[model samples]
Target: MRLSLTPLGVLLGAIFSTAVLAQDSDTTTITDYDVISAPALSSDRIKSEVLIEVTTVGTRLIAVGAHGNIIWKEGDDWQQAEVDTSVLLTSIAFADEQNGWATGHHGVIIKSEDGGKSWKRQLDGFELMTLEEGYFENRIEKLNEQLESTDDEDVIGELEWQLEEAQFQVSNIEAAREEGPSKPFLDLYVKDSQTVLAIGAYGTFLKTEDGGESWQVISGRLENPGGYHLNTIFGRGDDLYIVGEAGLAFASYDGGENWETLDSPYRGSLFGGHLDAEGRVWVYGLRGNAFVSDDKGQNFTTVDTGTRVNLSAGTNTNKGTQLIVGHSGTILEIDDQLEVKNRTHPSGSVMTDIIEVAEGEWIMTGRSGLLHWPAKITEEEALATQQGAQ
Candidate 1:
């Protein structure tokens, strides 16, 4: 029986959680191996590890995955980077050839300066909790002052409600401090060296304008009241797009200063998104579901991908082609004419992310680790390489 990747999020989460919890011993508990302070263990087998996200900085290929593993390739061999944390890194983005950022489990945001060679943790869940606590505390104080000064019933009612919400959030943060940082940052958008957006599960939205020296909680900027998991954030120009669990989508025309929720067609979680040069918005997720919006995400039409495998990640090739990769090694291509072609790898590996190496060539990473796509060789070519000893 073939495993379906329609709901890849739940499947991967279970695998990671089980691995972390199984580290119990006589003298040490699972907490002893806290991902927050633990550095990624050095291993020769990192090339075959379950990598989740891949991207390119110039000619260098970098990928991050389970156990906080981050690897980069420039020539023949892939070299593991010096990472500071062992949390599961889910998304990575580079603003230039020399600067990049990655986000992962435990609300981690790590930055790499000299290409992708080494990374330093800039933010994490513990720090995020503190930031939230302070923000809400300040909000509650301001709201209380407004309530005491206002005489109008309508204004007083609004102030009271805002104060209540802020206080509630503070209480939640205080409680979460005991459990440690559990939320994972699912995706990231690097605007520049100084400004970046890291979003994740449960409407975890954050921004750092001073290059991660200080981060601000910006989840309230979005209209996500239920705090649904934010799965992906990507855009082109000033038009930004965010898609997540329950088919939730948001668009920001003027950068991320403000957001408006878009009406998504599919009700399942959207795992990835792409914004084209022509301003077309493509969002895809569970069950091979994908939609394109030409009018800034106001309305969308389905793109018939001809497959039911979940689409995990996508990219716009340097040659102007659109590609989406997913479970079972499926690859869907959208040409300039909007024609969709779907192809699957013979190995049937679960591909989590893909990036264009050149015009026709590509590199992808996932459960089977990192490898160049179209990896299979013809039978004749294979037979010729297999010399018999007799």
Candidate 2:
């Protein structure tokens, strides 16, 4: 049997593995040059590059990908945006039309105040690793104190186990310090202009109350003791849901202050999730596995996608349809009744994300970069004319 790594695993391995290393100008010195500080290089071939995620800002479509490239389509053509970092961006979210943020490798979070034209680095892994180290250290100290003060045997046992976990996390933080900033944030949900939740590899969870100005490590809010990767975070109204590696699932009823674990039906990694307009929870991942929960993730039924290819991302259409894109250019359209209609593009590329441009039109990003279904866009001429009037 042939072994294959999931898309999430492949992305993480490419980021942290020692097989690929960066060298300085002389090609000899292993420079500690921070990707967060490095500016993204201008490239004319950005349209043909590997883009991971995309979103719509009003009438504009913005997409992000490798080497911190961010491109947006406003009137006629897709143009590159000014970005501060050179890190590989994995996910993008917008609080509204004007304020947006993008997350990627090295725990990077870039903010865009004017739609998606330009971005400034708001957070990075160096600061994240330091914050995580302090968090674990404090946790260890608190657990030790509790163990010393507790009288009940059951309480003592719980404190002791908590202390061990805190100590282990501290050790992992120390090791990470030596290897530079290796942590990567996979996905994020923009609740509003003031609140955002970001999650990633090794159960990394962070939140920012002041937009992207400052962030706090809040991984303790979840029940992921193994520190599994949190691949996707999404919210509908006050309910927030997170799905990750090994079928781990969590939900928060009152914002993110508290959480409860949900029983996941699939054991394989869940790459992404969707909380539909009808309040249904949909989680999809490896081998075309997908499940939907009608009662707030308490139970789930399988959603037959008809293909065995790994599903990476999904989006909600204006026509009350859900479209999921995955490897081998597979596109599965699930209606309101959970009926699936599958289609494939001729490119056969691994599509990471998709967005509906019009009623029956879509724009997708993947291994082969940006793609248009049916045709490039039948409304391009009319859209250009409208922009001219404005």
Candidate 3:
């Protein structure tokens, strides 16, 4: 059986959960880990470690993954930078060649000034809980005052429940602070050195304008009533897209100030999304399903990828070609003609993310550790590689 790469970060996020028992405050629970800051080990052998996200910083390529490891290719060798927090990092984004941000479990967000060399933690779940505590505490107080003057029993009941919920949240945050930060930020969007957006499971949306100096929760602007896990955020032109589990998706036109939920055709989770220069939005996820929209998601048509493996990562090449990688080392390449120009079938292991290292050569990382393939991988080459192993 081929190893599925979709678990790269998605698997880590799914396993981590904060189960808050509301009915019984004494029995409330949350996932906690004693995350410690450690120097990301630098070694040539580190390539075999699980890596989830990869991005290009000017002329350099950087990859981050499990154990808060950040590996970058400076010259011809891979080097890991010193970073705090040995948690599972889900994604990374570069605002420019000089600055970047990486996110992972425990609500960990780290930033680097010199490309991907070294990082410092800018925000964590403990701080977020502290902020939430203040917000909820204020709300609860206001609700109590409203309940005091209310004459109608109906209104009083509503306020009472609201107050209870707020109090519950405050206590939950308190418990979380004691247990350590466990909420994992799954994806990130770095607009610049000062402004950024970090999203994660359970409608966890945060924004910072002063370069993570202070973050504000903006999940209220989204219509995720069920609190679906926000999987990925992407943009092209003037539009920004957010997508995640349960076929949940939304689009923002005037920046993230306002968002409109787009109707998703698939009921399963969408792992990632990409936008082409031609205004086409491509979202791919569970079981190899991908849909493309030309009119900003008003209507969508399936891309008809001929595989059942979940697509883990999708990006546009320097030549505007689209490449998608997924479980079983499958690679789906779409050219300017909007066709599946080339495809590599399921190899032995899952390929989580793919990067074009040099023109025709590509390097991918995932559960299998690392793999090398052609930019336009084909069925013949995939089969030959599989046959050679036998």
For each predicted model, how many residue pairs clash, with residues at least 3 apart or on different chains? 0, 0, 1
Q: Would you list the rank order by lDDT, best first?
A: 2, 1, 3
Q: Which should have the higher TM-score, number 2 or number 3?
A: 2
Model 1 stretches astray by more than 4 angstroms? 1-33, 145-165, 376-390
lDDT of 2 by residue, 221-318 (tens): 99987888788888777899999888999999998889999998899888878877788888898889998898999999999889998888888889
Best of the candidates, lDDT: 2
Query: How would you encode candidate 1's per-residue C-alpha lDDT over 1-390 as one tens digit per residue?
Result: 112212323443543211221121012222333776688888898876678888878888899987788999899888999999887788899888999999987778899999999999998888888887887788888888888887999999878866776776777677667656666788899888888998986677999899888899898888876667788899875889999888999999887999998999898888889987677899898888988888989999898888887788888887777999887768888987778988876546677788887777887877656756667544454235323211
Which pairs, if any, clash in model 2?
Answer: none
True-structure lDDT of candidate 3: 0.73
Which residue runs does candidate 2 get wrong by more than 4 Å? 1-33, 375-390
What lDDT score is found at residue 224 in candidate 1? 76
Decoy 3 TM-score against native: 0.81
Q: What are the per-residue Cα lDDT tens digits for candidate 3 across 276-309?
A: 7687899988888988898998788888788887
Q: How far is 178's C-alpha from truth in model 1 (Å)? A: 1.5
Compared to the true structure, candidate 2 yields what TM-score? 0.88
